[model samples]
Target: QPFTYTTAPVPALTSLTPTSGPTTGGTTVTLTGTGLATVGAVRFGATPAASFTVVSDTHITAVAPAGTGTVQVTVTTPGGTSNGISYTYSAAPTLSGVTPNQGPTSGGNTVTLTGTNLTGTTAVTFGATPATSFTVLSPTQITAVVPAGSAGPVTITVTAPGGTSALPSAYFYVSPPVLTGVAPPSGPLSGGNTVTLTGVHLIEATAVRFGTTAASGFTVVSDTQITAVVPVGAAGLADVTVNTAGGTSNPVSYTYLPAPVVTTLIPSQGPVSGGITFTLTGTNLAQTTTVLVGGTPAGFTVVSDSHIVVDALPGAPGTVNVTVTTPGGTSAPKTYTRVGSPGI
Candidate 1:
């Protein structure tokens, strides 16, 4: 009598559960299909997984190994290797910093995150709340829009195939600073003027600046007030900004008026005996009305808004100021030269 021989059939892998995870390791994946009882080895791409267990003739569970990019998964038994199944490997992304971590409650604000292993980011969340929009700019950077949230701080997290990375130490807040008012709209070039600012959320003020020039003196008086000394600056209008931990306030206009300017004298020559009618031209004149010749005040007449006729009072020969003033400001002094004989 002769003995008989027979061949066994090889099993095919039909599906796999949770086909992805971090390259650092530790992800249990389930393989499902017929003929899994005789599985010899489980591999995720070219890297073989560890601690694989056969649950039934049709199912097997294996822990994923650390790797990068995409790879083909398969099972090897005494019969042979089955058809390859695809699995993706990824690394957790990190966050170094978030530009402008604060935003409005209504949300919809784009923020940039910088760090490492940020490629293939699947999602971003703010304290468990999903972001409205997200984009992977590169392996080290990601852009995400803030979702609607309450006024407070919340942790930000990013998720990828490898796994979710550690939460960033820094948190994002919702409320921003609001500017109410600024004092002393106009100041001299010498600065040193103390201007009080009133606003909300001003306690964490970091810096104060007059235009682009940093202020010489600054103090946070309260959550709604800031006192700062204006730095010496040129004549013109400039914006005053107060920066705080929350953010920077809207720029306030700081007017820098030039010193009183002196133009020409109305009457080039006057009688040495005095009483000469003259007008003056210039800018930023003081509000007080007075006439002076070489700094000497002479009796003057207010003819109009821009002109002043002055009758030189018993003064010696030479020039004098024919100045006019109003609530708005003063006019520059005009010189009136006095001659021995009075002539126009």
Candidate 2:
């Protein structure tokens, strides 16, 4: 009688531990099936794997070779080749820019990132610190909440299955500004006055506000100085503050005075030779800085908040206008008749 002949059963693939990897692939995947102990080769599509190791008759660990798109993974043995399993390759993500790249060191601001191939992001970082949170909006965009950090520039990075990418000097943390003083802390209620602001960490100022009104204009003179034109507001105290990329500064007090008024004038008449003195009366006159008689400046002394003595200057024999100016504003003119001695 001839000896009986036998054949080994064909290998059958049950599943793959991980079904996907990067296009530049170097992923280790676990292949589970029967008759794997005798597995002689593992092929990903038509390309052979970088390496492989048969752990047992039902399991094998293999390193996938570099690949693109999707491909079929198969195993070969003396028994037979197993059924194919699907594997996908992903592309590496990129970073192009970060909007509003600068923020306060205290963080809590949302910033948008733009780039290519950004799907399935795993992590986002500022320097070595992870973002407070992040959400992927599209394959080319992501919105992330910033994390608190020290004041200065830091690199931003994103990680995905493909790999990690970084943008050097990408984001900056700024310290909030401080306010020490405001020069000439008072101005006219009508505005249009420039004031100096002194403080620390005042760079990159974005706004200067008086009470709730924004400054007409401003210039950053230095980290400790700024010249801002006041905005009109009601007569009273207004809080002045400066804003920068870091944050809003501490508020300082500012006073806005109402315009002065001229209600009376002594005698209301003076000689054309004009060596005569006149008493002027009005509200808000304590700050009187100037007195004009018919467009000509006259010497004056502030007697009180409601009175002042002005020496009338020589002028033609006729009625002339007299006005007063103070920090509040210029006053309405008053008639001062100048008479010629005895109509000769």
Candidate 3:
């Protein structure tokens, strides 16, 4: 009697592991059904798969071929070809740019990412760390909160079911600015004085503030220096700070002195010969730069914020005005009399 031969059962595809993938297609898909061990080939629509491997009688792992739009996936075996299943090819997500591409190393700031095919984003990353949070606003844009990172540049990547893409350029991480000192730390309450700020990581400063008031203007001179014009502020100490892309700097002290006001002259009258020393009393006189007696410039010493000593200069024998000047500005004038010589 001749041995009887049994034929293999026809292959049947019940489902596809992943129903969609990138159009550039390299997606590994699992086809599950019966009689898969004898499967000889797999295809996406009319195009054959990049590769395929028979895992068992119930599973076949296949690499989908590069294609576009929706396509039917099928398996072929010695017995017969399986029924087609649906698979979709999508365009990979791309990153064109990121708004405010630089931020503090400590992160937590929101940034906008612009691109194409960004909808359905599964993840966003700065370097290797995932974003603190993110939201898909449209097919071309996404907003994400940055995660903490080391100082310097890092790649920003976006991932979707279709594929992952990185920005063409790098995003930057900046260290927060530091405040060490302020030159000419004291200014008049009326402001307008230019002061130098010294510190580290001070480049790209966007704002300079005294207490709650913003500086009138500022210039970044280097990574460690800046020049800013003080804005009008109340008398006494104000906290000065600098702001950059990295973050706000530590505060430094700034003093605002009220304008000087001359209230008295110890010797109101002096000889026209101009050889008299006199005490001048006033408020905000500590920084007195000059003294004028009878409209003539006179030598002077700042004894304190309320006192200054002056060496009277020769002037016409008559009553004239005496004034003092300081960083707080010229003082109000007081009367000074120069006596004439007495004849015998």
Candidate 4:
């Protein structure tokens, strides 16, 4: 005669992936151990998990159910309930706000965050990019230095032992204004020339400047374009700049030309009948568009930047005022003597 002995067939649970989750549940945890092929039920403390699937003799995937605080996770088979493993459930964190939410794409800007359940935060991010640095100030506050981020609106979030905060589109990244060039860069010292400025991120322009002086007027044509009126400035190079929401742009050089000058008039004396050719000496005369004798139009030709030949118009026997008009401006008047006939 022979004697036989009975053995136990209980399931053994060694561990669970993601040992913790939010109390609201819905976290899928993997159970690993021996003798789990025919698991009948998986439980978080006294409550049973929502759903579970057996992969083999040693693996099972289960979705957690609603519960609070720490709980013992266990599995049961036809033999009996298995030994329990520990798991924790915590509340989801809430984010009320983030300070200084807007920053340059170049990053390295410090930002302050305000919210609840922020203590023991493991990470902070703008979009998917992690912060350059961060410090948890308290359960409801955190400070983080943003990493380089792409220009545009983005969501900022904080992760702690509880979970990642579901913050909405809570931050913005702005690209600084950059100026490539300004057309018709040079104008007369008197101002009033329309200039076109081309660049990047030029929308919502608040101001345009010539050197230190603000432009008389401006219009934002696009994110990369702006039209401005040149303002009155001294004769010299003026730095042109555009200011937008982003910031001031790089400078483009503009030159202002002084008013035309008339130093001397050749053959200062002329016949009362006029029609006499006169060679005028002056500075900045190349752009001369008009010549006048006693307020009357006189034909003129710009021989060079410094010289102009003009035909004197009819005037009275006495002296009359002679002026030259150029792109820069009209020159001061000079005396032109008109002689009467000796017979008269």
Which one wins on lDDT? 2
Q: Compare candidates 1 and 3 on lDDT and give the better one.
A: 3
> What C-alpha lDDT, on a 0 to 100 scale, does residue 304 get in candidate 1?
44
TM-scores vs. true structure, each candidate: 0.53, 0.75, 0.85, 0.61
Order of candidate numbers by TM-score, starting with the best: 3, 2, 4, 1
- Candidate 4 per-residue lDDT over residues 1-344, each given as its tens digit: 89987665789999888888887888899999988987899999999999999999899999999899999999998878889999888777788888876767778878889988776688898899999999998888999998887788888888876788967788888787899998876668989988899998988678899989999999999988999989999987888987754557888888888889999999898898887888999899887878998998888888998899989877679999999886577899998999987993
Greater-TM-score candidate between 2 and 3 = 3
Candidate 2: RMSD over Cα atoms?
4.9
Q: Return the clash pairs for model 3, or none.
A: none
- CA lDDT, every prediction? 0.74, 0.92, 0.90, 0.86
Q: Write the per-residue lDDT of candidate 1 for residues 1-344, one digit (tens) a residue.
A: 99988555577899888877787778899999877888889988778897699999899999988788788889988777889888877767777788777766667778888778887787889887898999999888888898887777788888876667655545556455667878867766778778888888787788888999999889999989999988888877888887765557798888876555557665577677765465555555543355556666666655443445556665577665555443223456555666666469
Tell me the lDDT of model 1 at 332: 60
Q: RMSD of each candidate?
A: 8.1, 4.9, 2.9, 6.1
Model 2 over residues 159-181: C-alpha lDDT tens digits?
87677788899999999999999
* Full candidate order by lDDT, most accurate first: 2, 3, 4, 1
Global fold similarity of model 1 (TM-score): 0.53
For model 3, what is the alpha-carbon lDDT of residue 245?
A: 88
Candidate 3 total steric clashes:
0
Evaluated against the true structure, the overall lDDT of model 2 is: 0.92
TM-score of candidate 3 against the unseen true structure: 0.85
